[model samples]
Target: MAQIPSPYWPKGVPRALCLPQVPLTHYLQVAAERFPNKPAVIFCGSTLSYAALLARVEALAGYLTQRLGVQHGDRVLLMSQNCPQYMAAYYGIMRAGAVVVPVNAMCTREEIRYYMQDSGARVAMVAQELLPQVMPLLQSGEGDALQAVLVHAYSEGLPAQPASDEVPDVVLAPRQWADAPGLHGLEDAIAQALPAPADHPGSHDLCVLPYTSGTTGHPKGCMHTHATVLASNMASQVWRGLHMDSVFLAVAPLFHMLGMQGGLNVPVTLGATVVMMPRWHAAAAARLIEHHRVSTWAAPPAMLIDFFSNPAASERDLSSLTVLSGGGAAMPETVANLLQTRFGIAYNEAYGMTETASFLLGNPLARGKRQCLGVVTPGVDARIVDPQTLRELPVGEVGELVARGAQLMRGYWRNEQANQSSFFELDGQTFFRTGDLASVDEEGYFFMRDRLKRMVNVSGFKVWPAEVENTLYEHPAVHEACIIAVPDAKRGENVMALLVLKPDFKGQVSEQDIIDWSRERMAVYKTPRIVRFMDSLPKSGTGKILWRQLQEQEHARLATSPAQEIP
Candidate 1:
């Protein structure tokens, strides 16, 4: 493979620091050596030291291998929230040389079924509340590939104080094979197993199989190796200047890459204590920050919005929060500034996908930039490519952003066609097309413009929908808005803005008011001509506004409209 281009590498990332030869096992082993007595994880009022966490990982690894007959490369699905046990199960599977497939805990039965069948995961550790979602699939003879089910209590069974739960018999149905019990209690199994030595997973070994919905339309398993995970963690830590003893708040879902890599794995790599929460609640998060004295907190823009808006915001003491990072989606400028000015926390932003193993680029928390997705980190290369010509674009020119790095996925699991199209060779260097349209400034700061798929052609001029929507958001009346291209006879496509007004606004705001608002701010050709008010807009499971779906729905409505009859 050709070496990464020099211009793409971020400044200050020392080229002298060599990538580690040992895998994730090295991370855990180092933690045991350095911060053995420090709290590695804090889940549900219980804290686990690094040494104790390692002991549990070893015991669980033994149970999975010796008792359950799990072998090398055997896929084990982990479906749970952000908890200590979940981490134990994930690392345990990896330590046993088994591949870990983490499924989104909030996915519907159909969605879970697709991942379960696709990964061919023979074993699954399911949270008790989610048993209903996975039970039907497991019992319907559809997920026959699965060999065993391990039931885990999300709120129970810490090392010292175990939470109480009345284990329900009906929670699980018996399987055909009597020897393979359908529901194996995780606590019981871990309690019985003797601590075994941790197996050293090699760099080439597949560690995590994180499912991501790519631009290709469906979700696919992004095959992340031990090297990719470790490299990504190292890059993020170095770029962010995260301290080893820092306390991080784990509010993002562990199933997602942002939460898994940024919120969870990054802290573990530094031997830091992670304050865990199964789900995000603004008041609870603030309390945790005050109670745990969490030094760092990373979440989506919505989470911050909720935190600042909460009634408890005035009462909570959030002085410990020094680094407030945002991912999964863009942070609103107002919200970003409020967190910085009011809370005295720097807003750190990251830009990446599951394919890049969480973050390829991030701003340092100490001197973080809230707007742009900061410069590229070390061990990675980035370039802008022309969307149409498939040629490299100049640094300041707008084009699709592509990345090449040691952190890139091994490939989409079992999908050769996708793997082929995902990466392109330019001047003997392999670059993954990110599908996001962006540009780099003279200072190497990257700015996202819009999604190529989201670009709308109004008459002949290309109108970026995000620009229109972003401008509309600035309007006092408009709380949320989306712009789409609607078919028209006069113009090939007319710009239509869908908007939701602020709930407390007393004065009436017409569609023309929004159009006039945009007309003043933007160019005549770029302004939205058509406008429609909505009570609410549809959103994806990940909290992303589904603009394409909204556009399609508008088109469908217009296509089937009845013709007016002349009197």
Candidate 2:
């Protein structure tokens, strides 16, 4: 089927983009050549010019190739919070003709090990603060291919004396580490200035492998090539009207696809300045925006809520902001109204997944709808189809959303079964199943209704219940566990675990005990906020847990009860 022309498409924007067929590093090289002195990254008042950033990227690429023997198509794991070192490491890995496997900094030791082993990463670059989580993996002498670890401190990105009181204390501390065999400091790697091997990766070569959790309880990696990543990078730059002068506030985690594209990749592609934040602190964010004159920010609803709630936000001069957009969960209508009526800024909500580079559908800046996922972006063909029959649904009918576009990943890395289930042929075009239930309106805007996948949206983070349930099963007292989503006033939804304790340990294990156990075993966002003990859990004839049934009963119970503290 031909692309459906949406009447709601942004005016004057092309229906299709003529993207350059080259490696992603080409953009960085071009920017460095054109604007050598321009500030490429700004962190805690410290600036890294285009020339300096590119030089560091080249040096790190050389270290990976020469010292670590990272060859073409090799996967290099990168684990860090948002910082300047992350930017260099990301581009450097790709520059060395290796694929970047970015893991969340909050990942537990086991979670980090899984990503390193699954991606077959021979080398990893981690943040200094997160070294404790990664050191065990290197010392375990496991059969995993991991050979070298390079660590960088977040403080390396901060100025000697913080430019403002808003800078986090963690970012002010100096790097402290005991040298170990096969462990290298990031500064030492850059100082080597070893010549990088020739860049051989083309547009079609794999560049990134970002993992996404599934109902099967294991995370699957999405294989994105330079071409696929560039498609979204260029599309977002054009769609959002970002340019060389735009100063973007980077608060979203770079490991996630949205932040990787909006906060890092797009800004680098345009040679725009990026004000990097180590973590999301409302007061710090407000201060940075005012001081740096940040013009664009791609933040989730949770951050937006926090920003407006902070008393400092009202006093700060955010008049420099021109674009405010993001999507993980829908923006609350009340908060959206506050942004428009008070600040004169529209929150342009977008929809995409790890499978798609970052953007597929986004609310047009000039004509955005409240809580809507906007229209299909350029070069994308999106449709709604019945989940069971796979038949196309009519407009305004809720169904699974699917799309085929240049920005879509090649496929799930090394998971043929997942790849087969995720993509299907319809009218001679292969469309990736989004696993989201949504409907398109007459004006071509899409509205999300629900999710077909067993996932929870806590703030902006995705928590797969199966993954959390798997972690809970590791508890000594848990006999069986079922995780469900509960409504949260602040964070759209939070995880709630319904657990059946073992007969011998039933009276011994408290709800708080189980919650404490889970925190150490998984990412914080995936930790169950509420826990309930159960004598027995309902199951199907095959003894499969009836999670959906329990979820419905819980929602029904909440509907009738008066509001009470959830904890």
Candidate 3:
């Protein structure tokens, strides 16, 4: 049960890791000192060097502390697309001794409001493109808790107008913040601001607060300190053999843990350049990869599917690409085979979550299997265990995969009940229960078989059924709602809503009507793709919706019939 990893490990890679002990911002500090002139981020056609980037971060840090009255341990909200402003604000929040809470930029007003109210974030640095969704929360006079808001225009931080059509229209278009009150210009503030006085936060000081869609509740914040978050970033750089010359194409959304760790944090830690993209377009990605000679890119498998299938990518110079990696969903065998035969590149697969900061297990860069997640990283202790019994299983046995490592989060923020369920004690050590059912092979390679939770993963996005069902309950025409995951051809899974309409609206409200209403109320990723009207749901005497019974029934029917239904 205590077996080590397979012999198929990277030749020069270490089995254990020792990371930088300073604050997360220290990576930027050291990078500036070592490679001041090297580009820290390349957005559009222009570049922001390490020295300039660090200066901007410190300037904004000063503004948060000196001008905005942000204090240590206080939370500051950040909502934006992948761009240069994200980098500056992320580090600036930490450098000022405040915690950074990054939320998905695509979240609806109802969802974003919950994040703001739940995190107790009074101050925020948001992109101008997303200001309309956040404008309603600016009133501190009401019960709204917002104090100060800093708005940054994506184009203002760019060197010039981006020529590529891949950039999001919101970022490409000029911002209209002319008459908006309480919306201070962040770019302008940093331009005229001075560096803040040194405020040294301890290694254990809380830094990043990333939200995760829990198994049974709304999104809960995973509290991570500077030390805990740094472990994965350092390990990624070491595991991938990244250096100053390595160029990471930032296609993954930075708001997520995987992107924050590998796409942005790993590259910045080593003074390497990150090619930031505000939006994902396969053709545009091809142009940038060819033009910049990008060496490494980590994104979702969906992006890779589009990139390789698109003929536009073939026109570009992909000779510089050496490492292509991602994790949300498994890469198809065909894509992996093509990468191996044509590009001589391995699609490095890894496993991680917001609670783990990033990669807990990864395929070796040199040696890897088509669909296997490689050995556990340097300092992690992982094993397959019986989900209900908590007993470690023998090799190749199906069980719940659990991990204990430095990359683990401190715990869920302020929710002791949630923390109690998420972690358990074993052998005098505490380990986080991943709640994902997986198995370890004789060779020590991990394989994911299924999940124990009712959550849905749509193209790497976590869609909580409870969250979606709660939203549907607010609909006037919906009497009862239950969300389930169905097989999807493109995405790994698609959200399906099974509902029993109210007597008054049985024929009045259509399925399309419910779907359309949801799109306006929640994030598109969390919206239900298919809606099924049932005569009545299988419920208990207490009137509790029997979600699992319906889910299992659907699974049994789909298993017997290969032909699947879709939106």
Candidate 4:
């Protein structure tokens, strides 16, 4: 029996004191025993039984260790769209005692390289659609740490179409370097590998390296232990009243924290069925909900926005939905009301981040206080502190939100500076400082006040300023660039880039061209929405781009600006 110390065991938790530290694979074991024949995952029309899913994961894990030489604590990046392969790769990595590093499939080569370099990832299992972006990284010296690139044929399990004379031409890049072997074909790897008994990891074993744009500048890999993930999953399950038969609709991308923890891991932990989709399409989501009789949905506000705006939504039956939760960003009050009035479902507002597994707070259903983020979750401790003094604030005062719990991440991987600054000892308890500015009321309900940093939340996605500026700097016509978040009626905040043209070139590039350039180089959400040419951006005496000043100026401009319906 493993004796790894559990990171999360709240004071009142009976199991916390003497909890047996088991491997991450134990979640699958419990699920298999509870409901072996239950549908564990449903992709397109194909459903994998819990037993079948566990078998595949075991086989893949065996191949990862025996064939690929993946060792414990090795980082394996899972870079694919939402698919069963993503799920398999995730559990497979955990079973192999390797860390799962999930990268957004829509990310460009430049962005992917950063994660690979930062996480020191050795292997990447990528979708065919993303091969162009990933292949360059694999070939380039930029990702020297990366060892193998496994190309996944995406349409393997999806419904097959009739053969047509017009074959879809996918423009694959020319191989520029000596191709390193050990590239596993997605289906072939699973087919050829034999199922080995589960390899259980200890509680303290690192299960995932989820990259979060923390308070420290760029994206940092947060080391989530098996205990951290299990704690988070248990907290969410209790908060949401989830059960074994809970059928979850997972249209949100599994690569993201919310989708992975809430949508994928939670279902598997609870022996529930997760009906997943590659991308979030309102019509497709509604169809899945109707067909599968989905009981739960965990998505961002944008999905609900799309659902109401989608013309085909009215045709589908969505009455089976019992638990509807929205996180990534706050849900609009009007949108929340409309969901309850029209669809007879109220949205459960949640607060969480990648560093905290996924969720830290979940508001109960139909509770009409739109502004509040509900109470602190069970097994979690939250405190408000004065920003300047770091003194704990009373219940009603607004201050920086800080949390301490078992679900909190170990720390930024090998970044001691960040770890020291992020964690502070209060009454012998080390609390993780969450940079988000919020306030707690008398009822213990929390409300988001504002951001203490310049980070932008675009449709539930965190758009780091440094990442955006890095992408904008790539353009030859651009000499200086500053990306700021401007308030939007629809999206909580939209990226607005202030550009200073190069000395030689003036008025040669258009805003649309800049947008297009960014679209080709970066992820869609990270791209700037409004591009303004400027000789110089507002800067402080220290020469730092005054992002706050820019944000205030933009807010002032938008305040008096004519109100136009956001289309």
Cα lDDT for residue 535, model 3?
A: 87
In model 2, how large is the Cα lDDT of residue 260? Answer: 94
- Predictions in order: lDDT: 0.76, 0.86, 0.81, 0.74
- In Å, residue 520's CA in model 3 sits off its true spot by 42
Q: lDDT: which candidate is best? A: 2
Candidate 2 lDDT, tens digit per residue, 1-567?
A: 333466868887888899889998988999999999999999887899999999999999999999999899999999987889999999999999999998987789999989988899979999888889989888888778468999998887676787877777767778898899889999999999987777557999999999985656699999999999999888888899989999999888899887899878899989999999888788888888999999999887656865886788899999999999888666766667778898888898998888999898998888888778889888888998999988998888878999999999999888899888989999988999999888888778888865677679999997767557656766767767788998888888989999988678978989999888888988888899889998888753212467878988888988898976755
- lDDT of predicted model 3: 0.81
Give residue 546's error in model 2 in angstroms.
20
**Order of models, best lDDT first:** 2, 3, 1, 4
Candidate that scores best on TM-score: 1
lDDT of 3 by residue, 1-567 (tens): 474668787777788886667887888899999999998998887689999989999999998898888999999999998888899999999899999999888788778888888889888899887877887888646676677889988888664656665667677767668656667788877986767757677789999999986656688999999988888877777788888789989877888887787667788777788887777778888888988899998876656755876788778788899878777555656566777787777788888888999778888877677566678887888888898989889988878888999989999988999988878987777889998777798888998765677678999997767567767867877756788988777888888899988678989998899999999999998999888899888742212356768888877877798776655
For candidate 4, lDDT tens digit of each residue in 1-567?
111122332233333222237656787878988888988888766677888888778888887787777888889989877777788888988888899998877677888888988888878888777767877666666536566776666556544541221222221222223335545676667887765535567889999988874544677889899888888888787767788888998877787778887667888878889987766567767777888899998876656755865766678888899988866445655566677788888888888888898888666543535755666776677878887888888767768888877889999898898898889987678888888788777666777765667578988987767557755665777756677888887888888898888767787789999998898988888888888898877642112356667778878988998975533
Structural similarity to truth (TM-score) of each candidate: 0.88, 0.82, 0.81, 0.75
User: Once all C-alphas are superposed, what RMSD does model 3 give against the true structure?
Assistant: 11.0
In model 1, how large is the Cα lDDT of residue 354? Answer: 87
Q: Which stretches of candidate 2 lie over 4 Å from their true place?
A: 1-4, 454-567
